[model samples]
Target: MQGSASSDFDSIPEVALSRIWQEGWLAPELRTTSGERVSVIYRGVWTHAHGPDFRDALVDIGGRIVSGAVELHRRSSDWRKHGHDADPAYDAVALHLVLCDDAHPPLRHRDGRPIPTVELVGFLSAPLDDLVARTGFVELGAIGHGACLPTLAGERELDVRAALREKGWERLFAKQLRFQQELSAFPPAEVLYRGFLDMLGLSANRQGMARLSELLPVTTVERTAADGGSKAVTALLLGCAGFLPLSPGEQALAGLTPAESAEVDQRWDVLRQHWRLRPLPSYSWTLDRVRPANHPVRRLAGFAGLVSGCAPDGLLARFSELLGEAPAAWETWLSSANPPFGSARKRQIQTNLFAPFAYAYAEVQGQHGLVDWVAALWEQLPGAVDDSVAKRTLRQIVGERRFPIRRALDEQGLHQIHHQGCAQLRCFECPIAELAMRYEQPVLYHVDEGIRQLQEEIGHEASHRLREG
Candidate 1:
């Protein structure tokens, strides 16, 4: 019993052996008394060596003393489970650690000799338990918090931004290609412009707007006719999707009863045929608790108005122009009561317009630039808002990972209401706060000057287009 207890102290589990290698614990060292003796013992039978595929084995404790090397796994049983016991590849295993002592089947070495095995339960239990306990509580949160600010400072931030930009550009170019493929067989300008609108709609109601667009066939109309033809298709689609209120004779066309108009149904059918629509996967449009101003129908109407006002070829230029103007000027345009598409909620409209631009910028310039842009924009948002709300909104806007901070800014101010109409949580300390700190002065000035320069460039470019015409 005393001799067995002395030998048990030196035994090691296969699982612990693998862990030792992975965690950098096992290094070749000498014991002074033993004069170059390795401390860790392994046991298995010797096999082949010196080739493209060489292997050996150190089976039981006595075998380890004879030949010193080991490959390990969670259990000695894995040897058979992984089929290494049968493969020529594992002929060189030097040690086998078993959780339970069992007579493993005899395996032949290259020279065709039976291999020995080691039992490690008593040797490994205490040390492995201590290791697991220590690692389980490692302070990851402290590390992340400590690194956050330094990560955003100086050239480190710039390098991150550059990597983000490259990734963003790749994503944008890929999307541009996909959009083109979606609208292929139509004119390039019509494809580009309508793709932009679809992206806008997708941003708002994802599945709903996509289903609505599929039903209306804006791209199909553009393909069959010319540029402006697609605008009519866009209106019809938006109108059917409840984005547009019935046009003057829409009720008559729909064959509605005294109370309700059938125009939506009839027009949906006609547009479907004209566009050669295919059946899309079914989805329900969400209107539950949605405000009238933020309604999909109203937003679609605004989109229609914008398309009607700017012909397809001029669409890009018009967008650049609007973006180049004062926020006040665009706000006034959006808020106009008698605008062609009818009145819309000013905030919703601004969000729909600005959100797409941010996505587009991120796609083109890279995520780091998007981070800067979002932070700059958030700094300019109304002051002292809820941080959580800002974070949620910004997440919807920019995305996660490449631009988590930007998404945080966009979520500000939105409140979730319970059945009893009570606000649940107060969220704040968003990306906007970060932006305010980072670019409060220089970014604002740059944006103001940049807008002025862009307006001039767009105006000059427009004159050139007119001359070409």
Candidate 2:
């Protein structure tokens, strides 16, 4: 893939390009491929989410100060290749940056608005190779190493742990408040169902998934399931989602066996007439690069399974009962789910959907006892530390050093810090920054001692795991 003149630019990697962008290594005055003058007021937050590489960036394009998302690629063609052309999330993209302007007809958003494209080669501050050499290979979308890391590195490890835990509690409270706000607008069950649907889509197809939830709400799904069964629920969802293939051949093309296809279509045939919700266009989904298991089809199937399994109990009541039960039981149930969602996805649903919703539901019902239970459950829940943002922020906060992310609280704290401080470029007001400032100078002895203690702690954990295994 790396050869020829354009291929040379291809070899530079998107991460390198992002680093250059973050470093502000572009020429003083930049111009798009169409010769429009472009000015960089703010590069935006490097949020590696579903849509743009950078969010809420400020740019001056031909004297107009435009505020929107910014997307970067090695080649302009990658914009379409990555399905951004169809994704509604990219509609807000104000600017597109690329090394090669290979895309014919220029770039346009999903809404057909023209996106200003900047080819970096002509706008570089130095030779491409030299600029790449200077920029190195920073992680794509990672915020820079925390300015507070050095001062915090020298403090007691206990202090650092306590700080993260405090931030974690703050994050939990924020989630609770957000859920409560939604509860005010909608019933608890519907709100929770909506949240589950949103979380199931992960980053890529979240918008489409949320839209699906709104169209086929909890009340509708429950009634449909009660009347027909899980098949009815699955059929209703897939039909609305635009995934129920029209014919046997299309079903085959979509990897559905004849029997499997027939069973769903049979139910869909009956349901479609009664529930005439407008189907989402296929383009609304980002289906190309997603793993098979995490495919929207399987996620919808899993959701249908949840509805049928819960039955007359309803989602909120069943999940609240699960919350009171052992955490292992919940994990086991999720693991053994009909579609079998992975631990990571399961943890995501638990952390983002169930826990916050449970807290909100309990508070609205004035179940004072359950409120305290949910708070305790949040503390003990394992964090989804594998999340890219969590991993990136961990490195930003701790540098090359290793720190155990033991609880969901720890992960949530990292997320809170990232959204509020690092991503916003407001390090001066960060809690870690304030903590670092409390100690005027680095304590060499404490830094060394902390490192030693961390090593011993990690070794002990490994040994304990080995014994258990």
Candidate 3:
């Protein structure tokens, strides 16, 4: 194996470490820093949440089998630097794995007991660089031109758009119904808050973000902001979200000002104890290749600001009123002049959070006019995001035709079609497929056959993996 520079070890991504763990590439029988032998039983599920990297992992430490969370970092000092020491979420951590043991180990847990540490620098099956390369991630590939592209491009383009708009309305109604269902159980403020968090979470961390909102409810955020102001709100949300660093040194490294760092550290200490709050699990956030402007920490900061801004009445009342106000007012309230909270993200917040929620709340109160206003507003909101699903659906339906998704409603229509048709592999049943059949009748059959073949291939791949396991 080729040797790697120490700097290479420093730069190793946490996700690579996770991949390595998932593959069981490290030496099976290992020795912890305390001289105890360790053996893997079940490596556990890769929880892409806040607390531990791997959860429910079973391991044998010196003849005693243990099942708990497993945490990983590039360096052993990251345990304290990342503030896991102060977080009760790591209390059940059974084993600590690190690439380098720069600091002394076993590292102490929140309850003061030393966690068994395994330094992987010496135990890896291949060179560090090779392992890192092997663990590299790949995104979804491009889809080819579909059978319906030619016919849909000529006379049927307008008809296709109309079809999509109809589906978009269906998608909008579905979202409104989901919000109504949520409102029936919880308060409107809570439902809106959870939805906002889900939008902020984006694609990667949506589930984890929704889970965080549930853990720290809207009422708590409102009450905390009212009592302690923005500083307190910042500490509460970021701390609970597992973004606040425990030590002043880590805070400084995280680019926090001295006063800001002190406030967060001091406030979180009191808030965690008083509220009996637990931070999300380790590795809950997906930070790899994420732009800094869209980092979970930054989004949490934006949420903190929003919480403080909305104060006494909470998000529900404030945003409901804003629905009647100008778009500028909505932009200001959502972004607060932050560049990271750009127009695109704000548009998404509107499409996903505001419109459906307002419509749902209005319908429950018998405010039919207000519901209509929200539905109208949804149509006018410009499309800000052009994601993979929209692109893929476009390729399948229109080929290379430059049919722009100009509005949020159209994008929603694309997603609705994808979810209902492409994702379900129900090509023949799709409205788009029906539209395609009118032009090139064989297009629907070919598309349906292609989907069937893909499903069979997927089934075979899954069965092969199962048999190997």
- TM-score of each prediction: 0.36, 0.62, 0.61
Candidate 3 C-alpha lDDT tens digits along 25-76: 8886888977899999999998755688989999999999999999998788
- Candidate 2 residue-wise lDDT, 143-190, digit = tens: 232234644644566777777888888888888899999999998889
Q: Which of the two, 1 or 2, has more TM-score?
A: 2
lDDT of 1 by residue, 1-469 (tens): 1123423422433223444433434333322111223334432322212211112322224223544445444444455554555566456554443434333554446667554444433444345545434333221111111122232323244443333334333433344445435444554345445454454453446667656554644444334223434335444655455533454443333222324324444555565565555443324466566544444555554455555555453544454465545345556654432222322234433433343344444444456665455335433432222235434432322233244323212222222211001121111122222432343333334334544566687865433332211
Winner on TM-score between 2 and 3 is 2
Alpha-carbon shift of residue 131 in model 1 (angstroms): 12
- State the C-alpha lDDT per candidate: 0.40, 0.76, 0.76
